[model samples]
Target: MAEKAPKEMSFLDHLEELRWLLVRSTIAILVLASLSFFISDFIFEKILFGPKDPNFITYRFFCSISQSFGLEDVEICDAKMPFIIQNTSMGGQVSFLIWTCITAGFIIGFPYILWEVWKFISPALYAKEKKYAGAFVIVSSLLFFLGVLFGYFIITPLSVYFFGSFNASPEIVNEFNLESYTSMIKTSTIACGLLFELPIIIYFLTKMGLVSASFLRKYRKYALVIVLIVAAIITPPDVISQIIVTIPIMALYEISILISAVVGKKELMESTSK
Candidate 1:
């Protein structure tokens, strides 16, 4: 009997498909970003700069908790931050606007971007795998946005409080540049968002047989240490701040282990059936 030729797609066909995906994703990002630009003032004032104020919701919540515990020395009880933000560059405002729009675009377009990525990889997966598209997108996007919120509401504030209040001498004052402050917020938010996709990454790796539950379990302790180190890097030096940041990440790691085990079982079942 004659051997059947392997199915193949032309290079140009692949390129055309990829081009449309990019075009659609870019359009979605721009539309969302344009909407975000209209609310940029609110985003900056109410959300971005909220951590800098003592009366902010997070600060108020922490203050109430402290009062309930009878802790009189809580840092959240401070009247105001002692720092001033300034812009020194000539085109700093314009540059800031452009980058801020792009950042907003990425955040809003994250789901669509994931969809495009899924489409690219879906051709290589089995029918059973394709069924997970919606769950993967929804769960991954939720985790990412949750991470961004945690970074903004918790990690950023703690770091700002620690670094802003730190001084070598009583006479020294802290004056931060607007660009620098915004950069810190943006980096922290996006970094955490990406970090929270660990379980999804592990799921795919497990599906591909590149990783297993045993491997993850064996290295679990090391992962915990790394998570704590990362938390320390992103948060204030205080143990409370580090613990708060590490908890969710530890939870995510445990979830990743469960996901890997599920994937491993599914692969085993499929193989046995074949």
Candidate 2:
């Protein structure tokens, strides 16, 4: 005998499920954040302030490339980061530590969060689709982490370098606040992480008949402009940094188009076979 279909859930049941999902996700984040306190010093000094140092890996890598190309005059080769980060408020340090740990926990617990989200939505999916839950969570988490790394290594350093080095007047000193610096890092990583989910999002949108490969292709030029705009918003107001950020995003958009095409084709085949 064939297996019976799952029973339909009531509106209240769905809400209850959603509530549990949030509860579980929050617990996971909190647990991970608590663990982060054990290594808070490393996070603050090595990871957060890494970009602020002139000898940071990103800066050194760029400096090497400049020297190889005989672009010694390029400012990227300069060994100066004329800025200091300070906390003005008495409670600022404590608040920053707590929030930063929370952000880190969110990033680390992303896979668990995705699993909870999958469980919440799995009831609505066909059995075949539900079986791919593991792959979904893994791929989504991988993409998110990759985006975070890209943001940290590429966007954050560029933003720090540009803002840290820029002096409107010779007498002005760049003393950045702790909150502002941390905010920039958080924004860059989280923004890129979400942006990197483009292909996954496009796949679902195409599957839902909300978007199409043709639509994406037709608006490719517009997408390019939008990508550039996002890059400009995220990176320093320089051609090079914006272009560096734009390249990956545009590539993701192209990949999203391809994903949409494949999903569209699969749906078309399924409909035709019916």
Candidate 3:
């Protein structure tokens, strides 16, 4: 049996389709957001403010690792951080609450969002491509959550530690604004989450003939430099922190290259058989 081409939908038809996708996605986000709002206290105190505390799980885990290696004076093992978070604006708290809910909505609703996106694109894909739909969603979701965890547990703590301890002079105090602190945490978490979609991105790009494994390999060094630059931008200026952040990103890039190769080979074999 011959496969049929996707129907040519009008501009308005496409718009209507997109509108429904958005509507469904929005509903999902709102439902999740409403639930999260009810538990906002726990989210704010335990998850959002976690990195700022000396007893945060990441800090304790690293502290234990350091102790095992006889590096007992590791900075993360400290009893307390020498900084404070405060709100300078009158509406800062209110704004923070609203934005936090929106962010939580997006994160919690990400799987549904992916489903909608896949639905919109699936009609254009080959039968073989459609077969991998479940795998695509599972792998992408896992990578995003892992990236979020990395950002929350690793990047956030390192940033807090560096910024909190930094003092140009004894007269200066490190009283960070609440808005700024939340913004840092949000950016780190969300940015890493998106960045971790590299493999999925490469897979699609390979399918579209927009990227290839050889090209990625050829530019590997340049990609490493770009990854390091990104790490430096998102993390503290310290070499150790930058290296820690860059390592996972570099690993993701290698994985992306492998995915691209697999996708490219599969597509090529299918075309040849046809």
Candidate 3's C-alpha runs over 4 A off are 1-6, 229-244
Q: What TM-score, over all chains together, does every model reach?
A: 0.87, 0.92, 0.89
Query: Where is the poorest 10-residue window by lDDT in model 3?
Result: 233-242
List model 1 lDDT by residue over 120-219, tens digit each.
Answer: 7777766666788998889989989998987788778866776777788999899998899999989988888998999999988997889999998999
lDDT, model 2: 0.87
Candidate 2, 1-274: lDDT as tens digits: 2232378899999999999999999999999999999999999999999998888988777667666767667677775888889999999999999999999999999999989988888777776787799899999999999999998998899888878888999999999999999999999999889889888899888988999999999999998998788777655444665776788888999999999999999888878876
Off by over 4 Å in 1: 1-7, 10-16, 66-70, 233-238
Ranking by lDDT: 2, 3, 1
Model 3 residue 40 distance off true place after TM-score fit, in angstroms: 0.6
Query: Which whole-number lDDT from 0 to 100 does residue 225 have in model 1?
Result: 94
Q: RMSD for each model, in Å, please?
A: 3.5, 2.4, 2.5
Model 2: how far residue 46 lies from native, Å? 0.2
Against the hidden true structure, what lDDT does model 1 obtain? Answer: 0.81
Q: Count the backbone clashes (under 3 Å) in each candidate.
A: 0, 0, 0
Model 3 steric clash total: 0
